[model samples]
Target chain A: MPRETSRDNMLREKHGKEIDDIISRYPVRRSALLPLLYLAQREQGYVTEAAMKEIAQILKLTPPQVYETITFYTMLNLKPVGKFHIQVCKSLMCALVGSDQLVGWFHAKLGIKPGETTPDKLFTLSVVECLGACGTGPMMQINDDYYERLTEQKVDQILSDLKKTGACPLKSGPFMWPEARSAK
Target chain B: MPKHELILLKNMMTPGYTGSLKDYEKTGGYQALKKVVGKVQPADVTQLVMKSGLRGRGGAGFPTGVKWNFLPKDYKGPKYLCCNADESEPGTFKDRQLMERDPHQVLEGIAIAAYAIGAESSYIYIRGEFVLGAHILDKAVAEAQQAGYLGKNVLGSGANIQIYVHRGAGAYICGEETALLESLEGKRGLPRVKPPFPATSGLYGKPTVVNNVETLANLPHIVNRGPEWFAAIGSAPKSTGTRIFCVSGHVKNPGNYEVPMGITLRELIFEHAGGMRSDKKLKAIIPGGASAPFLTEQHLDVKLDFESVAQAGSMLGSGGVTVMEEGTSMVWAALRLMEFFFHESCGKCSPCREGSSWLTQTVRRILAKRGRMEDIETLKQLCQNIAGRTICAFGDAEVAPIMSTLQYWRHEYEELIREAEAHREKELPMAAARH
Candidate 1:
């Protein structure tokens, strides 16, 4: 039941199968650069040259090709990220709503700027552009989930929950639904 | 409608202006070109355009005649009149409608432009997604060539003009003139630094005049109607002619509404768009396409002109109006648009390339209910760093949704934060629900 212990062994042994599935999805094998990097990062926690070369071999592309795409898109982290990756929206719309305050909160709470990981490796805070939820104003994301209608207290709760259980809970309150808000 | 006069919309939806020489001839299509072909010089054609006050319709609103005047009359280089048909603006689909309904009108305009600029060849650089429109343009071009209105001696004037349709890989940046030029040259679609503008340097480093589809469509009418008569439409003595406003989104009837430039937003949205779909109340409206800032319901009376829209802290951007009814959450809409910007960043500049993705992640996190209070201010600051600092308007374009939403509805975000705090009081673990 331990997550990393057996899952690590399974990932290590099944990494090749994952690589093949990712590579086969693209018409041009080179298009698998992002997925391959993601897999390599997922397994090794960072994109090492050896892992990149293995990805290159699997996808029939040069390491530079993979490197270029990885470097080009900001979503793929070349290095390790904190357990909780907090990306704050930093485009004009988000700024107008107060993304600056979000960044400041992260700085005050996590002690890190836009692109750096926290010293404790528990959180990595980065600033990003419009996340399309301009209506919510002043919002951010931690990994896959989005937290709308953000507030300092909610942020503290999110951090506290994340620290306790290693994951942020999905929004279940009636207020969290877009349909409910639409009716308002 | 009553004997549509000259320059721009001359052959506009006229009977049979497609790829048939006989059809075009039936409509008196090539008559203006024949009138000036050998008799009038290229400089005289430029003079006519200058006098007409035709401005570029590709969102920049630069004077069309002045742009042609910028090209060296005697330089004799590879001057090009590129018809920018890459209509990628999210809410703007008027160009597609024009090309689909009337292709010959645009071809005739291209012919006249090529002759006026002394461009031996003209290329209609289209968005690749316009497969059907491309076929129609090609067929029309062939028809025009066969009729001698293009290629060899046009109507016995001994002047030659070649029209070609070049397709572009779907990239929004290519809508930028220089980037469109770059895409035409078969390269990555990235915007070039301006100053040389397109007149001094364009296409293959030669002088090129990148004209919009609607702007080029106005040419045949300008020639037929003559300069003085053609300059008297719309509001504002300075701003001449009728403009097409594509009314879309929450409107009862969403379509291209061609009206005089001086109409109010209220008229366009109410009289033209038939008001909101459900009469549920119009919360906000994006006057231009996605890139322009939002205008709340209070600003509906603002005149729908380029200058008026700008004065109200928004733009008449491509005249693509999108209405958001009261029930719509600005946050969700901003997220959706951010996803688009992040997906279409093109990765040419650092701020836009990185900033867009970062914005998406941050917003997604907030939407996922794992957001923090400081995310709002962080988003605002991030947008500030990205806007006006990128190589192209893409960065600024990406900023419109979030900034405008916050401008009109910061309290909504605060309310969400408050709700989250209230929910926290229920003794329920908030991190378990992940939808």
Candidate 2:
């Protein structure tokens, strides 16, 4: 975790302006907690306790108030997720389309199940609810972008490409490449 | 496939809707605003809505009139009326359908609601991801403004209602009314603690009414068709009107189905959704999105209404019905939902933040063929702690999947654990020592 001093500075420098902008939009200050956290998280990869404390201070809220806001929604990650945080959609629509096998494959390749960061810190895998892209199920989101219609072979190729490209890989939503074989 | 039923509810969803003022005017849109403006007092409108028993279509089933009534008539500050278009709930896409197909309907609904609530300005808080839908709504609002339906002196009645379409930054929690208001204020989408409720203290600390897209869509019809007509359609005595259920998964026909409130699950799936897709028989149904309690084949005949579903130990949440065929494992399905709640958990409370993680881990342990008999009981205990303890229903939403799955499919979980134990014994032989 980043130290409190640096986190505080980041919140003051980046999140402070964003928090002001968000709070100004709302007639209420308490509602600014979510966006402030988002801005805080973007400034720092994950929300440290220090950053959360500062957020509470900035919003004229208690630490619990900030904690309650963070705990209510799922998009904000408090702990450090890997450089490429792989979020697989394991909800009903995606499950029917074979999200399980893909998840298992990720477990094998990454050596970490959902919620575990890889030893090398290259990836952190977690399962999410329906990403609202049910039409393209068996999908995974890496960072901000989405990758749909996954297969083991495709997973292998995608991993290889991610390994090759230090930067986040481009999204390839199912239609781009056919799976090696039809398990069906 | 409902074959796109164009009932009185979907009057504004005509194809090739350009959202132009002339187009909406030609279609007899905004006439209700013209009809209700001078003729209807805000209290009379509120009474009409109260009599109709129009509960919020958003997750909470609070009565719409009651919500509007909560706004302090004595307060002289600026109040807001927010249209919650952040349709991020899993399996729930009814709002998206309403917005995409019928933008003007929603706008008209907003106008009626603003008039009823005594609000001068309203904001349609749309989700960021809904680019197309937002565009349609934005254009519709602009058209309503041009047609003297949204701006100052709407329909020449001197009741000025200015509607602004505020786009959200793609957060699911914003679907919650207060969170939607917060996001509309250009903040991150996080839910607020209730009690003061939006009607009393919402949007900018004024008395705001944050209604869902579907709930607001019903406003114009309630004003135009009369509340009595709406009350007569649905199943419950207090709850009125048709509900749009977005049926998906393992079904032959999966789409948005709008039916009278008292319709049965059997009718919805077999008659409306065209039954299960494969030869695989129905295993279970998550009747009301991921948050609601799961129902087995036994509850298929249960009436799909808020009260009936609640009586049966589940809610008619967002009316997103997901079907699971026999080929699917109930254990996996439950785990999948748990995983969603785990990842989606904003991680504020120890019970929910930690409990969801624990549930997902336990489910994974069970699925990975590394199961313990004690883990099942621990899972139940964890769920017990998580439920009703958090700031939002999210904690309770997390519990439904865990408890419902265990209640309906305990045998399946036992089988998975036993299967895993056997596999561990055969493969590792000394795997027990590792633990």
- Considering every candidate listed, which one attains the maximal lDDT? 2
TM-score, chain B, predicted structure 1: 0.92
The deviation in Å at residue B162 for candidate 2 is 2.5
Q: Write the per-residue lDDT of candidate 2 for residues B234-288, one digit (tens) a residue.
A: 8758667888787878887666667888789999899877788878888888888
Query: RMSD for each model, in Å, please?
Result: 14.6, 6.9
* Residue range with the least summed lDDT across 10 consecutive positions in model 1 chain B: B1-10
Query: How close is every model to the real structure, measured as TM-score?
Result: 0.68, 0.76
Model 2 stretches astray by more than 4 angstroms: A1-89, A99-128, A133-184, B1-5, B12-21, B184-190, B423-435
Candidate 1, after superposition: displacement of residue B130 in Å?
A: 1.0
Q: Name the lDDT value of residue A59 in candidate 2.
A: 75
